[model samples]
Target: MTKLKVAVIGCGSIAKHRHIPEYAAQDNVELVAFCDIVAERAQSFANQYGAKAYTSYEQLLQEADIDAVSVCTPNALHAPISIAALEAGKHVLCEKPMATSSEEADAMIAAVEKSGKKLMIAHNQRFVASHVKARQIIASGELGRIYSFRSAFGHGGPEGWSADGANSWFFKKELAFIGAMGDLGVHKTDLLRYLLGEEFVEVAAFVEQAAKENSTVDDSAVCILKSASGIIGTLAASWAYNGSEDNSTVFYAEKGILRLEDDPDYSLIIDYKNGNSERHSLGAIQSNEEGKQTTSHVIEQFIGSIVEDTTPPICGQEGKKSLQVILAALASHDTKQIVRV
Candidate 1:
């Protein structure tokens, strides 16, 4: 088997913790190059992983004999970098919130079409055991028509997760584009879409910089989303949770309520309308919290898609659909009206 040579752009927290390590663990992947604006960071990862380092992504793409690349940069760079990688005949595993705008996301999809290479968005939440199980159960019609749902992803802030604490690019509007909604909300948007197998057609949201000092983008947001099938729900993304991370979701169905990641003991819980309850012990959801190094199946799936010459589970088109909701939410917040996605 010829190993797929992979390069990583942006040696930031996501690259260091998830992309690099995960790629290295794949037997069919060769970590061929690392790129970062900070040469030292790139060089350090290169030394650790036995790959060359480049300060310029252009140079890395030009020089490395790579089959794939992971764009783990800030939200603003996701589209441009992913497009460039695709044009260079490299498969792309771009971190989520695909791009800053729908146009940018479209451009990425167009690039994939032109390049004939795979482009997978790293929406790792969909790979969570509980989320996958929920999707399976929903598809099985065991939930009996989900009427509504509430999904949330909240933490103290990105300061604790980014490479630069308190002064991270995540706090800057220019670099991050949007804050909590882009950072956390987008994950739920993708997850909800995947879980219900439905699209969010409308959104009304209140996005505010409620907490986190020295931030130009939103620190808290609550969005009301209506799916195409008329299922309505709330999606909240916050950097103001202040306590242990609250990444959980609950679906109110005709049969019962399905709670995901709400309880530490059990990852999924289902309460039937007929007075019966079931608890599932799926593994923990991935977190940025210290000492919680849960595995994300994103890299494995991306590599598998490329090796098998098949479309990724979360392809460019799927990513664009999920991003539409976030873009609509932002517009809804700004206009103070319901926005069609």
Candidate 2:
């Protein structure tokens, strides 16, 4: 079997914990190179993996004989770097908040079309077992009409999880584009879209920099979103969620209430209108403090798409749509009015 030769761009904590580790575990893949603006960082990962390192991503793309690359760079770089890799005849699996804006995402999609290579956004929440099962239940019409929902993704912030720690790009407005909204909000919004099987059409929001005093980005945001099918909901993202993470969503439907990632013991819980209840302990999600690698099958799915010659589950178009929800919410915050997606 000819294993897929892969290179990782941006040897950050995300690469250290998720992308590189996952790629190394895959039987059909071999990590071939590592790249970072900081030569020492890239060289460290390369030495550990027994592959070459490059201080510049352009050099890696031009010289490495790799089949694909994982764009684990900052929010602003996702588009340009992924497009460069795609244009260089390499498949790309980019991190979330696919781009800072919809226009950049469109450019990425255009590049994908021109290159005829796969481009997948790493929205791993879709692959969580509980989320997968919840989608199945919702698709089965068991929950009936989803009237309202609350989706949240929050944590203490990226300080501990980022390679740069306190000075991580996640806290910078120029590099991150948006703070908590870009880091945590995109995940829930993307997951909500997948679970409900619909697009959000409008949003109203309040975004603020309430947590980190020195950062140039907002640390908290709350948005009210309405879906195409008339499902209204609240989406919250924050870096102020001290103590423990809250990555959960609850849906209120005609027949029942479905909650996911709410309870530590049960990942999913359904309470029927008939007074019956069901619970599922589908294992815990990947955690930073606990050092859990993943319940996130993002890498597996990305690799599978390349090997099988299938469209990525979270393609650029899908990622763009999810991103538009966040973009609309940002506009809503600035204008103090409902923005249409």
lDDT of each: 0.93, 0.93
- Candidate 2: lDDT over CA atoms? 0.93
Clashing pairs in 1: none
Q: Residues 87-175, candidate 2: write the lDDT tens digits.
A: 99999999999999888999999999999999999998899999999999999998888899998888899997898999899888889
Model 1 worst lDDT run, 10 consecutive residues: 286-295
